[model samples]
Target: MAVVNIRRDVEDQFYRYRMPLLQTKIEGRGNGIKTVVPNMSDIARALSRPPTYPTKFFGFELGAQTQVDDKNDRYIVNGAHQADALRKLLDDFITKFVLCGSCKNPETDLKIMKDGMIIRDCKACGKRSDVDMRHKLTTFITKNPPPKKAKGSKGAGKAAGQSVEADGEGVASDEEDDDEMAKQIAKEAKDTPIAKTGKDADENVEWSVDTSEAAVRERAAQALSGSMQASLVLTPGDDEEEGEDENSPYSIFNQWLLANRPGGDEGRDDLASAEIYKKAQELGIEKKYKAVQVLLQALLTENAPAEVPKYGAVIAKMTTSEKHQKAALGAIERLAGITYPSLVPNGVPKILMALYQLDVLEEEVVQTWGKHVSKKYVDKETSKKVRKAAAPFLTWLEEADDDDEEEDLDDL
Candidate 1:
């Protein structure tokens, strides 16, 4: 079993990370031709994905149905596929799912967020990159979520806490009584007169809770009856603040966009961006340039930079400070160079230049970013490629600085 770099572009035989070459077998007659990926399980193990994912990707690419036989480790595609073609498709899978979008490293884990967005957590660079939501695989990953960890695992406590929080306020299956109480409370609130003045008046008004002897007896009787149980009243503000406290504005906006998205894939990026802008305005955070940072994070994925400018107008309106600008640029670095290198197009230098001209990023920061290379996200060669992409911007910044220095000397 000869091994090769997960990224075949790196032909280095000594590349540390390696996977076995794809092996395929063609079987059956003309009408029933099918391709079996004999070593797909082994390949998937190397790539750290469920074998079915790649098998399904094969089916998707070849326009054929696929059968994943996990029990026997047999994955079959309806049409006969060449080993080379499958290998190429496997590379596509690596780019989209396996490899870290930032560093281009294959060491990553898939995390499905609560809002149904899939993120890749890169082990090497310690950066979490979002997967593009527009892909067909996102729907599959959401429905057929990754298996839950063993109860005693490190995340067990967090999962349990989340479960408890979800249980708060809204009991999923409460019968007639809870509904009746809610209606009674609504009726009382509607009937209650508004106070003309505050301070001395009804500053703190309690909702619905009966403290009478008869009410107590009724509750006791219900408990005793075994047919009914006491329903707990949650604090009014508790559940309302849960969404805000637990999630960032960007996260909420992202979920909202996903839910209320328009029909058809045409101009989806534009529509999503417009919706985000609308949300920002509604929340009164539109003027906060930092809002654009959140928007940038939610909208842009390693493989999808086309939507980067969707919020460009909103970003331009903000009076961003140097610190905020640096943070925004850092987000781009994480997305383009570190988390998703291959997916980031060559226009990154142009994007940086545009931002620099707009005063969104300073020359010093841009130069520093270009010169600093981290192999954690990529191999030396790929790191060099990232640096090369930043070269033009770095050169322009250097020349500008030199010209300024010369002008100062002439003034003296």
Candidate 2:
């Protein structure tokens, strides 16, 4: 199919579309009076190519295609994507023709050239001004032939880069007027014969409309997919306390991170932000440190039954040798309320074996009289309270007590 531009007189369709300056000046030789004219070369160069400026011109894709007649002698200028040709045609027409028709006005206007035509003013009627619609500046382009085109141009008769055939037909070679790409397809379809009612021609072309719709849908989905653009590497102590939506990528990514822990397979060594985030979340919830303390209290600290594992090693890093006694005292205070008294059934033997190593220090209350030792210094009630606190753990005392109890029957 052939490509055609808007008919003469419509340059604004494409060319002359640049941002107009408050006062733009046009170069001139100043034959008599000075006036401005547009840069024809600049307009020509801009129109001859596709994507000359924006992706589109006047809302029409410069390189879009349209359907046209395929007759060898007859020329049909398709309405779609013809702005480039339309614009050039108008520019040429306007440039060559000038002067107002209403009054046979002189060429005072820079756009028009006057040849001293008779003034069509109503001199008898108080010189009332009148117009000549036939030879007006704007309409003159329509009456005259379009500007001559250079040889080798694609669609010469129509506009820039356009070529006309021997039959006076124009061909739009999209390379010259890329917009004709679709137009060419239209011509092929028109020239091809139609099949029987149910038969189809070129299934690919038939699916084109659907494919184009799918493309648009995909683009929209991608645009609306992700969270707001933010730093992917989330910082600790981030303001997560703010009311967060369940669908937040941060939360989703955090869950994903927990599913995959740290130090996984070597192939997974390169974790993304989503994975690392999940791992960090899991660590917060595991509370591994507090868990170990609870089990240790059940064994050595609270005298509960089941033998807990060697906590000394698990907590070795937390409390060193110099601080072991102090740490043990602290552990006792923390475990006092946490009761898991079923250790006897699960594992108390190993616990007692390890506990045999602790010192049985007791609280002592004594009163001394200036460097003199006294029998009344230790009281019975204070002695009773100290022994009661450690009564369950003082298993070694039984053997010592046996010696005293041997004569208890006679004493009682």
Candidate 3:
């Protein structure tokens, strides 16, 4: 029956977000022992996540099987776990899957995109954050998405401005208020001479327009002399300008990434990977591989080597194919060689290693990138310089591959 702050780290006594303390009851004996979370539904309700999610997370963390009895409101995990231990594990679940990456608020909803990516849509900050797709629990969540709320429910009625009284009387909603205001306006308008007899009264008033040729010429002369006429004049580069505007989504996303860089705020990291993905969705570029390229160029700065790992989850979710991997490499090329030329000789290797470690760039893709210098991302000379800078890392990857191949031969 005891309650605790949903985010245990936020020890503010007046914190609004609170959940029931996790209760574990162990059943059976020896190998048949299982840990049961009696108040998991209560905890999950407070967290706004399904009960099975945390239960499955416990199973993954403890290397045990989990069972869910939705009808009985029961969740079981094989192997006996203490309340404190399970509570700690639940905190891990909250950190990874519950808290928003931007504001650390727990008022977030887990949304599974059509691409099978799970993102936390934070209601507090209105930022969408990506979950670490590499986690095993993501697979389970994708398979079993949260149930959709029924339409036209009480909550929907309230949202739509429908109010109900305790005595079953219906109050005037926003629509009714607007209708009354409109009727009052019409009645007031009828008192005036303009609305006294509708169109018949208006015809009694005389109105005329000067559409003579001399008058038209005078109007044209005035318009031509005005500053507004400049906008009407078309130039040879109008098509190109219009095209650039058409591609403004990528530019807009890039500007957002630049403005909201991680560590921009004091004592907080603003790595809004899910927010970036959400922006891509809004721009209709979530499925485009090129969007990943924009993310790389916009996010990583001079300290790209240190920053790449922080956005690993973001890159992993966006880069799902070899083309995306290559696009990511192109962004890196532009970053080290063109954007920050000081990173040419030394920082490039570390950046490559970071991306490799995060599994954002595959071995073969890196090798292929290092083998040739194309003018696709940067000028040929800059491309060559970037490739030259990446040689040491490329050599290391080749050596590692050769060792792997040698091990295969020895086994054969």
Candidate 4:
């Protein structure tokens, strides 16, 4: 029954949001050993999610199979795991799926956008941060969506909405009616005791007609029930009825570029490379590569020469053909001359090596290009510096060919 902060890192005892400490029980033995989350429902209820969600998350993180039995309220994971480990993993799940990226608040809801993207809409900040599409759980959430709640149901709409007390009121009213009926029956019994003997002697005594207590109680109960019935009734249902237009990957890529234009002014042609790379991820896995040209340009201008390998990995994946490879190398060469600080003395060499390892740049093209000096970015001095940085890598590339030939001969 002890409580801890939902975000345990806050370390504040007075924090409003809390849940019971995770309770896990180990079961079975040897190969059949498993972990049962005894209080998963309680924890999930506190987190406003189905017990299956956290249970499934545990399976995913721990590389185990999970079973969610709602009927029996039993959630089991296939291997023994410590309570502390699962609790830590739960925090990561909260970060990825529960909390809003922009506001870092847990008061958010998962919504599948028209484009099949999961977005977290923050109630506190009113920002819709797109969930990274690459996570494995995205597939699960998309398939098994939460059930839609009825509109008029208690706790139906806003997280902070009040619940109707009709059930409680009805019970209270029924109890009062029963109590009143009991008192009336006792009073009538006391007042009209021994009527048989009285009837024989009552010829001279006047008698008044009155309904029995049982009849009065039935009439009063019926009237009270009729008054409690509601005059108007409303049913709630899911309202996400409309579908959204499906834009092509290219169009989406363009839209992403337009929305994240470097400066506030649309006229400005330049943009920050890091920002572009970050936003391009939202275009999903398909169209991310198309942004490589702009991404490379931005990185060349904005990122330090030594940072080429960092962004190079991203842009390298976009290269699908010999032409794209040449273009990427050409972009690097062109950016080499720009007045902006040239890559560190060996930045180009590092970029080439990474791309080559990723199979994005061909050995033949790199060898040919390294042999020739090109000035396209800024001026002679900067271009010279760029080539000098690439010299060591170029020497290695040439020597690598001889080594490859020697290996082939030895194999022969």
Better of 2 and 3 by lDDT: 3
Give candidate 1 misplaced runs (Cα > 4 Å): 148-412
Candidate 2 lDDT tens digits, 182-220:
233333333332232212233433222345888868643
**After superposition, candidate 2 runs with Cα above 4 Å error:** 1-305, 310-312, 315-319, 333-336, 341-353, 357-389, 395-412
Total backbone collisions for each predicted model: 8, 25, 4, 7
Best-performing candidate as measured by lDDT: 3
> Top model by TM-score, which number?
3
Q: Rank the candidates by TM-score, best first.
A: 3, 4, 1, 2
The TM-score of predicted model 2 comes to 0.17
Better of 2 and 4 by lDDT: 4
Q: Estimate the TM-score of every prediction.
A: 0.38, 0.17, 0.41, 0.39
For TM-score, candidate 1 versus 4, the one ahead is 4
CA lDDT, every model vs. true structure: 0.56, 0.28, 0.68, 0.56
Locate the minimum summed-lDDT window of 10 residues in model 3.
Answer: 233-242
Candidate 3, residues 1-412, lDDT tens digits: the string is 9999999988898876788999999999999999899988888877767788999999999999999986798899999889999999999999999999988978677889988899997644557899999999999988888655322122100111112243123222211223343334334333322221111233554556599999978754543232122211111110011122223555666656655675332333676678778877787556555567778876776677778777787888888888788778877776676556656666777788777887878988777666654655566667666766666666667667788999999999
Per-residue lDDT of model 4, residues 160-235, tens digit only = 2122353233333321223343333334333322222111122444544357998767744543232112100111
Question: What would you estimate as the lDDT of candidate 4?
Answer: 0.56
Clashing pairs in 1: 101-339, 101-340, 102-338, 102-339, 102-340, 103-338, 103-339, 103-377
Candidate 3 or 4, higher TM-score?
3
Give the distance in Å from residue 118's predicted Cα in candidate 4 to where it truly belongs: 1.0
lDDT for residue 337 in candidate 4, whole number 0-100: 39
Residue pairs in steric clash, candidate 3? 128-274, 128-275, 129-274, 130-274
